[model samples]
Target: QYLCAIRPKDGRLVLSTMVYADEVNASDDIAELKAVSETELPDKELKMARQLVDSLAGDFDAERYTDTHRQKIMALIERKADGDTGLVEAPEAEAAGEVVDLMAALEASVAAAKDARKRHPTGVDEGEGEGEATTPEKAVRKKKSA
Candidate 1:
């Protein structure tokens, strides 16, 4: 396995590559790579950014997430195989008026996110309990309510 970090330099991106060996060797390799890169490049900002990144490094966990879109696609395939038509009209896209103030939009987004967190403390919807499948209508209603 290999870990790579990309940072913006000038007008492009520069990648710092490091190979992963054993646990001990991986840390040594990363440190050596960083040292070599830092010595070759005399950019204080990049050096500081690299140091900050190294300080925040942690183990990679792959099992903590699920691909909902892939799951939904497979479910739809199964339904079609079972003689279901599986036809649904796509929702109309809402027109977003011109965004004049980026700061206000960002602030509104943060406020909305905080409100949502308070509404759903567990980060799960009311009817989204384990093994309790949510239908399209239920999903639409939930979004409308929100």
Candidate 2:
């Protein structure tokens, strides 16, 4: 039997192999397989770049992210599976006929998003029932009521 072990030695990673045998001298069979050098110390430019990246890093909260488009598609599939064909067709996107003022368009989009956030603080649309009761009875009641 052979066992491989890794350890840090002189700021480098050393891989050592040990042999275990019932009838053989294990010490004579043991070998220092290889040593992997540590990463080189960062240069001034690399240090600056690393610092810039570290400064931009922030805590990641996965709960704050959602695939709304995918959720919508799944909901549509569910509705179709349930034999509900009253799906609303989305309006066609109009082509950009001419060059638009980029800054003005960006400002308008920002303002619209702000207004939407104010209207739906929970980020859920009205009648979407995002936080509603999930019991089967409640679901049936909601469907009947609707």
Candidate 3:
């Protein structure tokens, strides 16, 4: 809403903003407001107003947040001291010849399914394989299927 002071001689109305939608019954110094209404407000006055609001409503608490990574590192160091052997697997390097050929074929098949939406005009979706089995027995079965 606007507070309008209309001049009777002319049709023009002098408009002044009263309050914002979010600010419910916000307090202001009437004397300073009246003074500024006639003149211009200074940057020092604006900064002081912001400082007053922050002093009344803002809470400064540092202990509310905790460092999770530091805690995890400390726990891992303790486990290392106790001689705990974690199940860490070494990454396999790229294979050569026939192995590379088979890997390329599998990758191409997967790519075809993933990019089906882009290739097909009618937008027919295709599903992906849920990877090769984990156990040795299942791995053997998977190799037999290939």
Candidate 4:
């Protein structure tokens, strides 16, 4: 078999890959990319990016997060075998909100994040303990204190 992951010599593998997104305007060279820093980014964009990351940041609950479609399909198969169609109808999904512009998407994300926080104040599902929540601000503060 070909070794795509680990190298026996160093016990590590390096990766070089491009992102799947064609919309993102990325520079050809790493040097070109490194030339730009957060300071150079517009205040609005930087702030939104920070907010987006902060809001989305959380410990993923393996028990909760899963491939719902696959689960549904399996359940559907079971139901079909048992001569029943137990709630496996394909549900309507929103159209892929393809990014026409990055800034607009960022703004929408910020708004959505705020709304999500409002809905789940503890950043987890209802009745869950606060131990699951981890904000970037809190983590940074903790590190500084330590």
Highest lDDT, which number?
1
How well is each residue in 1-146 modelled by candidate 2, as lDDT tens digits?
Answer: 34454433354344444322222332324344222232455579556755665575444333555556667899999999999989579879999799889999999998898578546534544355755422332323335553
Which portions of model 2 show Cα errors greater than 4 Å?
1-42, 99-146
TM-score-better candidate, 2 vs 3: 2
lDDT scores in order: 0.57, 0.55, 0.48, 0.50
| Full-model lDDT, candidate 1 | 0.57
Could you give candidate 1's per-residue lDDT for residues 1-146 as a string of tens digits? 34576544333334544432322232334444555434554589767877776676555443444556667889888888999985856879999988688899899998898568546534544456664533343333335563
In candidate 2, residue 145 scores what lDDT?
55
TM-score of each: 0.32, 0.35, 0.24, 0.23
Candidate numbers, best TM-score first, in rank order: 2, 1, 3, 4
Query: Candidate 3: worst 10 consecutive residues by lDDT?
Result: 5-14
Model 3 per-residue lDDT tens digits across residues 47-120: 77556555654332334444565677788788888998895456597786554678889999988886874454
Model 2 C-alpha RMSD to native: 27.5
What is the Å distance of residue 112 in model 3 from its true position?
30
**lDDT at 70 for candidate 4?**
68
Q: Deviation in angstroms for 110 in model 4?
A: 33
The alpha-carbon lDDT assigned to residue 66 of candidate 4 equals 50
